[model samples]
Target: MKVIKEISLLREALRDKRKDGSTVGFVPTMGFLHEGHQSLLKRAREENDIVVLSVFVNPIQFGPNEDFETYPRDIERDEQAAYEAGVDFIFYPSVEEMYPHKAGVSLIVNSRTNVLCGAKRPGHFDGVVTVLTKLFNIIQPDQAYFGLKDAQQVAVIDSLIRDFNIPVELVPVNTVREEDGLAKSSRNVFLSEEERQQAPAIFKSLQKARALIDSGERNPEKVIAGIKEELDSSTSGEIDYAELLSYPELERVEEIQGKIIIALAVKFSRARLIDNIIVEI
Candidate 1:
């Protein structure tokens, strides 16, 4: 596959593709390619005439104490995986290339940023929206793919697209998981042998919560309690947050109705893992 590092070069390449009446599908990712990322790229490849995958570790999306500097990177491996997944182009831009000067204004995020991972990591989604805005503009694809593993992130991007009238279609792909049910993540490498064995409890608890909701449980507190009980009994990891909230908007709901998300984040010894299940009630 062709790799373009400069912004202008990538834009020119895309312009040429558009002139040929090819539809572009974009998959934005930080490197350390895995099956989960490839799943998005494969789907994008199937849907669009030209598929573009970006491998930039967006520094702005990371917090001060976060693992920005230490976040994983393997461009050579990522390129091979992208090529196998049928990617047409790889946009591997540097931080300087992405942000040459200090931003004069920021994307005003909606109230959805006040809960879940957002509540724990302040300004995280702001960085996410800002970087995504830049990527969307650069690629100008007909469709963009994101995994449901970051359901809240998908929700925020959905809101951003609707509010800002971004032309690209936001395609939400289902979360890819291991045989044991733990959501696949780059941070999984940090999990100790013991921690890896226990990590599946996160997804197990989410499944329990989904079962409880499907079995006529309408109270949000009760559903959350069921999930927490499972996590407490099964895993040694510390619970970050186990919540049941409105889907997409993430607002607190008194009763479980319409659509809702049962989300959780657990801090193991080394890795912080997150998982969720979206249910229509």
Candidate 2:
């Protein structure tokens, strides 16, 4: 797989793939690739004629005081993983290449930025949409694959496409998980040995929440409370947030009905892990 660092070079590599109307699948990721990333890559390979993966750890999307500099990155590791996962080209751009000057215009996310993880990270999705707008124009992929682990970002992007008329299909892949059900993440390495053991409880609690919903428990408060209670008992990590909201839209519901998401985030000693289950009831 070619590792491209320039926009011109990237377009050159993908030019032939598109000249004959080949379908391109784009997977945008920050490095420190894990099984979760590989799952998205593998799915892209299955569905598209050419798979393009971008490994730029976008600096703009990270907020001040958010520890963006410490975000894990290993391009050598990611390169090997991408090559094995069947990526045709890796668009690994530099920050200077992506952003050369202070921006005069910025993309502002008015809605969907006040809940879940977005609530705390101000202007995060605005940066996401801005960079994504540039990437979408550059790659022009027929389909873009995103993991549902960051489901709120997916929701924001859904609005981006709808509101902007971007032609690419938005494909939301299921979150990849460990054998014990802890969601696979780059941050998993930060977990203490004991914290790692307690981590799977996050997903377990979400599973229990789904079971409650399936059992005809419709009240949002009851479902969220049960999820929190289980986490409180099973794990020592501080519960970051456990919320029930309408899927994709992510609005609160009076009662759990139709498509809904039960999402959770937990702060371990070192790692902050998140997981969610979406169900239609």
Candidate 3:
């Protein structure tokens, strides 16, 4: 596998590859290889002619108080994982290469930035959309893969692709989980031993929300309350937000009738974990 660190080189390589109609599958990641990332790579390997995995830790997507500096990185480990997963190219660019100058214009996410995690971190999605636009333009892959662990990001990307008419397919992979139902995350490492034991309850509460919806509970308030109660009783973490909203659109619903997401974030001692279950009702 080739490791590309320059934008022009990647662009040239992709342009040449496109001449032969090679189908490219791109997985953009802030490099900390885990089961969740492996799942994306595995699926991309299975379905595409060529797979490209990017390992840039995007500086823009992080907030002033976020973990951008300390966010994990081990390119050697990621390289082995990507090679094993059949990745053909690894576009691992530096921040300086990605942002050579101060931004002339930035992509502002007007919608989908006012709820859940987005609500708390203003302009987070703007950074996300901007970086994605750059990657999408640079790689120009035939399809891109993203895990549904951050389903809200999936929703925003859906809008990004449509609104800009970017020629790429958005493939949403299911969240990879541990044996006991804890959603696999790189941040899982930061969890203290005790917090790790209680982390499974995050997914459990999501399941409880699903059960409520399945058993004919349509009131958003009640469903969210039930989810909060489950988290409160079972975990040591503080609940960040437990919301029930229309999927993708992420707007509040009077009654759960269509595709909806029951999502939550919990702030543990050292890590904040997020999980969700999407269901069609």
Candidate 4:
């Protein structure tokens, strides 16, 4: 597995690959290896000739009071996982290398960013789209892969490609979960033992919400209430946001119809976890 840290070197490598007709599949991530990230790498490996994994903790995407400085990082372990997953290249760039001069321009996908995680963490998606655009340009991949855990993020990237006419194909991989149904995330590391035990309630609540919707319960209020109630019982869990909204669009829907997304975020002692389930009704 070759590791490239400089932008020019990475771009030159990509140009050479294109000349050789090698299809590049890129997985851009904020380091901290987990099974969910591995799933993305595996899928990228299967579909493309060369799989490039980037491990840069984007400082722009993190807001003040957020865990940007303290976010997990283990390049040694992540490289092992990526290499075993058949990744071809690892682009490990420094913050200065990524944003040499203050990023004068930003790629803003507005309407899509005004809800969910966006509403809570302002400018979150902007930072995401901005860095992703930079990575796409630098790597010049034929396709890019992202996990479906961040359903809202998937929507934003979808709009970004459509609106900008970027040639790269955007692939959405399914969310990987724990044996007990909790969505696997790097942030899961932040959960203390007690918090980890209570973490499953988030997924359990989603299951309850899905059941309510599947059983002909259409009222959004009722579904939301039931989910809230489940989390309310958790002595260690703190509810962040629980809503049943249209998948991708993220607008609140009164009656569950086609595909609706049940997304939730809860804070444990040290970590904030987000998960979602889609139901067709």
Global CA lDDT of candidate 3, please?
Answer: 0.92
What would the per-residue lDDT of candidate 2 be over residues 1-281, giving only the tens digit for each residue?
89999999889878877888899999999889999999999999999999999988888888997657888989999999999998999999999999989999888999877888888788899989999999999999999999999999999999999999999999999999999999999999999999999999999999999888888899999999999999999889999888899988899899888998888889987778888988987
- How would you encode candidate 1's per-residue C-alpha lDDT over 1-281 as one tens digit per residue? 79999999999989988997899999999989888998999899999999999999998888999999989899999989988898999999999999999999998676788888999998889999999999999999999999999999999999999999999999999999999999999999999998899899999988888888889999999989998899899888999998889998899999999999989999988779999999997
**52 in model 2: Cα distance from truth in Å?**
0.4
Backbone clashes, each candidate: 0, 0, 0, 0
Per-candidate local distance difference test:
0.92, 0.91, 0.92, 0.89
Question: TM-scores for all candidates?
Answer: 0.98, 0.98, 0.98, 0.97
Candidate 4 deviation (Cα RMSD): 1.1
Prediction 1 TM-score vs. true: 0.98
Inter-residue clash pairs, candidate 3: none
Weakest lDDT window of 10 consecutive positions for candidate 3: 13-22
What's the residue-level lDDT of 95 in candidate 3?
A: 93
Candidate 3 residues 127-226, lDDT tens each? 8899999999999888999999999999999999999999999999999999999999989999999999999999998898889888999899999899
Q: How far off is residue 39 in model 1, in Å?
A: 1.1
lDDT of 2: 0.91
Candidate 1: the clashing residue pairs are none
